[model samples]
Target chain A: MSAPTEIAIHHVDAGRMGFFTDTTVCIGCKACEVACKQWNDLPADGSQFTRGGSYDHTGELSAATWRHVRFVEIAENGGHLPQLPAGNEVDVDAAVAAMENWVFMSDVCKHCTNAGCLDACPTGALIRTEFDTVVLQPDVCNGCGYCVPACPFGVVDRDPRDGRAAKCTLCYDRLQDGLEPACAKACPTDSIQFGPYEELVRTAERRVSELRRRGIEGAYLYGAGDATGEQLAGGLGAFFLLTEPPERYGLPARAESPVQENVVPATAAAVAAGVLAAAGATAAFALARGRR
Target chain B: MSERDATPALGTRGEPASWARAGADVALQRTRWGDAAWSFLFGRDTGYAAAEAQPGEVAEANRRMRSGPLPDPVEGPFVKAPVWTWEVPLYFWFGGVAAGSSFVGLACDAAGDGRSAAVARKVALAAVLPCPPLLIVDLGRPARFLNMLRIFKPRSPMNTGAWALVAFSALGAGAVAADVAGRPRMARAAGAANAAIGGYLGSYTGILLAATAVPVWARSRLFLGPIFVSTATASGAAACRLALVAAGVPAGHPTRTALGNLETGAMLCELGLAQLNQRRLGRAARPLHEGRAGRLFRAAEWMVGAGLALRLVRRPLGPRVHHLASTLYLAGGLAFRYAWIEAGKASARDDEAVALMGRGAVTRGDALRRPGEARRLASAARRPRHNGRVGAAYAETVRRVSLVVERALRP
Candidate 1:
């Protein structure tokens, strides 16, 4: 029989911050990936970029990418890609063997409180649950691409395979049953943790302190703790713990939403269009009359 | 502006009756400022004393998140929950039909083309047929779409639009029927009717969106009307070109050329207005010029530009080119609508946009404090706050006006 893998899982409300990823502790095994997919019933995206430089082929989060373990491999001495440690040859095998510094972080959708995707959805496809997590209703989506740009994080996307909008539902159905999300369930390292939003924030803070005490002072939560409304995109529903800055993982430094400003110009253009159209119609009539 | 125009005579014996005149007259007459003080208490749509606040009003609920602890539901910024979905169909149907019908009447009137007039009348009636479907299909409860007619509220664009649509539909139908009966005299009257109803049909859509609390639509209310007019004209011209070809008129018919000229001019107007829109909108406008919708709008605009150039050069590209150009212009207009809707929703989704609008409201409140303006805002503000449902329903009314403007101005 297989040994039971213990990973921490918690339930949280929508607004409280959570997550502090300690990349230094990660082994890049992608146990989190298997757990999320196996539990979520997510179809496997075939690995093509796998086996290259300690990297996992799962590059991002999608409806399928509920959890993706990113692998960033450094030289034995910790340097750039395509270059070998001073003692080793540059072949793929040697590179993998010589690689001593590898940072693995599992990423997922940040259930944002000020979710622009949910706000922009004309058909109410995107909704926030009582848990404060943002989820998508596939049936209600009209496939209007408004949410694509409205999302500051570029998390929500249209399934080109299907026309409807798609994003992680944060395992909403499971949470309702008083269970943790699938991704957290399968994490072998206790790295991808889940819990109440407030408790998670506190846990993440304590975890950061613990790591800092252990001499890994660089550990920090990305969208979690101090990521306020001004600094983040409406505050992430699922905040992250990270050792490096958010931008290193492709998050924007600051976010802005344009919905309010657009009404003024849109209204003005509409008004001008109305007046000009009337004038033009009148002119057309005059010209026709002149010809007569 | 011309002496000969004489304010374009609201109703002439030779002209068809317009519903807009009734609406405009109602609006002008119901100006509470000029009427007795009691009028404010009983001011039709503007009057809130009789109506109960919607159920959602007791709880400050935005379908989207509301920041900084929900305010007292009874406090200012109280909104009636949006009763209807902001249906995309309404945008298309109302604007398309209005533009198509208005063009038919106007073109036939201009050319003295008897067959064209008959076709125009038929098309005009057909245009009005879509309004009910548009309104009903987009409603949360399609059955309630008809309740809009109960009160003739001047401040409520939806009420005005409902009355206008009904009036326009009757006149449009009568005009067509007269033409079908070979009543040239009545046909002339229908043309006049079309003229009167048609003028405001296109402009009302702009007014509708402008009156909303939706910051994107409210801020640019002034220009949206003109843009709608321009696009509608371009579309009307395109529709006319199609009708002409269907009628077996040769590609180079004088009427076709004239329609082409109108379309070209309108396309130019739309482009110029969009440029102006870019300047006024700041970052929100980025979605209009970038990404898929932007690409489509730009391509359509380019096609119109090329078509305009071809028409100007007088190369006589034959029916195919003209037809292609006409379709291109129509496509461009639709793209513009798509872009506008996308941009508006995008703007609404942002917390910052709300904050910015919130701050702008503060400054606006400050500005209103001067002289008599503050009193009006305060009074206007005193009008019962709507829940999100009511706001949505109200938005539909404004959308109706926007739709009309889009149709009326089609080329």
Candidate 2:
């Protein structure tokens, strides 16, 4: 597999560093989640046990929770396990086999090549770090909350306590000190790998091919190369290798910066239409007055 | 002032001695001021009570996200809901009115109707007065509101819109000042400048909403701008006409008649564009057609329709019809802003809508990968380096255009 060429484009010295989360090896321990919260000093959002009957207690990534572990239980019939009949006697071994494949994916900020939050931030608070990862400067953010909705992944959120938007900083402070992100460092199984963007992409590709060769046909790289058809606009700096579809991990299959297609055209059309309408109305008034 | 008068003597005259006590029972019995001070110093509830007190819909949505059964992969909110509150839509409405009225003032000035122009300018100034405060108050940190002006970011609609609002307000104020200072030429020039900025101010709000990941807003990107501008025009003209009439302008006056015609025309355009946008959005537009947002949109439609009907029967209804129609148009305009913003919030929560949008993008991507198109994309992706000359030329062109625009916009 050829290495991805777009690397160290932002800052030559540090190189573009990112995560390659391989769900195949993830143990669903959520040590990454704990380490992230502890490192970032992010307050716990809530403690309600999810009704999904999964071990996922932290619902999803929020302003407080940066790393979320998703659990997808697949039945032997290639569907979710059905609720068993209350009175029916079931075979334990058969039941266990039916629910054998349980997928656990630890999700974090994709840190896209073209980040939506960075593009949408009016306050210049969200910036690209030397590692080519997006980071929000809480001090600079005036709590406009535009970044919250702008993030296609729904990663950035407004901290209710402080009113400023918060998200994974890709451990920018740690990277500056020559260390990996808290999540990747804490990951026990090396499922969450952090390194140069190009190296990670190559590693992810090789792993996916290896998995497929070993009869894991569903294994594929997402946001790396063209594995999932068209790439996310500018592609994601942090990519993933997943056995299931991207949506199974609460990730969009296709994402684009709204600025790329929506903002400029919409602004131009609006301004043009406004000018035309205003001019037309003025002309009508001018003509009416002149006639009078 | 004497120290005795400046400082209140604790436990003196009518004051109770218990107020100074540190005991819990004494603290409870203290005056409201003492209680407030105690709470201010020691309260653990310093966190945002407002965040905790979310509206029922939002609370319910949060509850579902927390405790509901796992959503189908393709059918749950994939984006965070907007944190904007009542202040945002209110700001949009006021900003629209300011923009709209400035346009009317410019139109009146162009038509040589000085009285009507002066009234419209004043209306514009009055409308713009509350915009800054509303916007600042809505910010997560009101003190950091100045951060919006700390940079020039054209990529962000919110940033550019802020700059436009500042310029619009300044020019609107200048126009009003020129009118007061008996400088008709200056007033006319300032009014024209304000109207130019106003055109942007009216439309940028729409762009701001559309340029997000929200399904309904993004899907209707093309129409939101025009829809907002049209509503702004209708409302601005309506405000001007009402003011002109109240100032004793005859119903038959050319300015009054022109404004009336303009209001009706803009209202018609707004209604048409909204309908077209809703149609184009398809399933993504469900938020605009259901729940609280839907109700507001329907009310706006009814009000606009009624206003138009009133305009049509003005000959029979007399000048009273003008007042009624103008009022309806203003109310309808406000409703449009609120409805659109509310709809956007709802749309962000609709996972199915966003999932469908993502699916649509994937389908388009698939279509593009057909044989020759795939090769083009692959080659583009494989290109080792960006062509520097083309990049420099593009940058130069952009720089030159912005310089020209800046020069033209300068007052």
Candidate 3:
């Protein structure tokens, strides 16, 4: 009874499960990050040194770092601080006067409605779980990195430690045990919620409205619905509620469902090119025949 | 212990030392972040006080450190996703050449040029024979390669491509065998089917790249297929030309000229389409024209031009000139595939390219406060150079030249 653009041939048994990460409430505790690794048995990306950037110590999502908490500090004085002027020239006094605004978001896989990784897999390695979340079968993945580039959000990655494609599995094992995901369970603020996809969307919508009512400008649900607002990647299975545009959170403004947008045109272009080449050869043969 | 007890707390069961170390490390991290954040707050990297009118924009230094579209604070560059390496592009090159050979063989057979057709068939077989092994190499094991067939996902281009490669290789080999065995009718039918299969084999590679979400490849989706087809046809004709002349088709012979002319025309098409693809992509095409990949692509273009010049303008009527042209064309074709594939990889690493998806061109309108701030904030990144008026003039000149070449040497 569900409509997805990728595969209609197969029938799935279970209801779709997803996450609704509300960035507004994230407290930058790194609990979800710690929880995801503990559950997934992933390693720390590396020893944390002075990154000297934002509050972000662990740089990004990778095979080792399954979950990432992004800390975007938007200063009211644009992004300038008084001590540090543009480039190497520093104005220490001016930097101190710069205004800072913090937006914390715990990032994870979208588990897209039309997954590019699954569609691009040549070896049938990436598969949708019974819970309707995309999961990787390690035994089948042959280290081919097609899925890495295929992801619109750039989530799935090849583990440099082990040459296999890997990403968040939406805690498929825990789902089997009738439990919620690790990240959601660890969220102290309940910013990251886990439940049935439909129920979460309803709750998320009300939460956005409540936030807007409280004078939170641009507090909207991304991938909510095609009719309401942005329905990127045919609507992210793991959607978000953001105060800023998607780009600020490193999410694509219009996450493409490549299976439909990129693939269809590619197929049509290939067919047309093939026909042109064939016709060119035929005309040559016809000319040769005429001479004979 | 039950499953509840068996599962680690918070999904992890790190050693107590590591946990303690993690906690201590976070404290250390906090100290460092605190210092940096303080420095940042004081206009450390902020350019001007007036520019700070907006709320979210960061100082130029912070943007420089981590400049991608995503909110990721630490990951500096763009997506460093490299799923396909040398094997995939090499596979595409070989597969396209094989398909092109089939086209040549079919045309020869239709025209009663049995000797050339036989050579073409052998060339087709030789070109395609390595495809299966190459694919196996990419997949890491033979069983993994075979696993692609387990599902007939017409919805997935990668699956369809796997099947198409197998079909083309099998039919090409069969046609070659039939011709060798003196089974005229069998060879003719197989060769005909091989020709049909070749069309898919020649052009499917472009679709494979285009269908992906990589900004550079995806943006040029409309033209890459045609570009690949043109390259395939030229390379196939060049291969046949080399084989035929080696077997003693004289330099001045109509067949040599005809094949050379076809190669020239197809290379011209490939060149124009590549430019068209680049122009259409705007800033997203920077990776295709900028680094090692860019160097290789420009080299390929020059080689194509060089091949055409050698055949058309060079003096001395010898098979050597034609042979050199064939060699240049072949080299150019290989370079095209390799460079295109490499460029696709590099393009994925571009955070700006990723951010520019759906909304191409990092313009002033993106953020009114800065009014073309991305350029000032990101001078470290290589800028894509465009020459629209001159490019149009050049395109027109190319069209006129191609027409002249085609008319002067029609098959």
Of the candidates shown, which would achieve the greatest lDDT relative to the real structure?
2
Give the per-residue lDDT digits (tens) of candidate 1, residues B1-411.
Answer: 011222222333212112222222333232311222222212132111223323332111111122232211111111111122345524553455466447656655666766666665676666567766766555432333444453344443445666777787888878777877879788778666765566556556655544443345545656766767777677766776687689888755556666676787888987887787667754345456666546766776777677676666556555577677777777777766665665554444433333334333322332242222211111112232233566556545643553344335435
* Candidate order, DockQ descending: 2, 3, 1
Better of 1 and 2 by TM-score: 2
Candidate 1 DockQ category?
A: incorrect
Model 2 lDDT at residue B215: 85
Q: After superposing candidate 3, which stretches have Cα over 4 Å from the reference?
A: A1-13, A48-52, A75-77, A80-100, A225-229, A285-292, B1-80, B140-143, B314-317, B360-411
Docking class of 2: incorrect
Question: Model 1: share of native contacts present?
Answer: 0.09
Model 1 DockQ vs. reference? 0.04
Q: Any idea what lDDT model 2 has?
A: 0.73
lDDT of prediction 3:
0.67
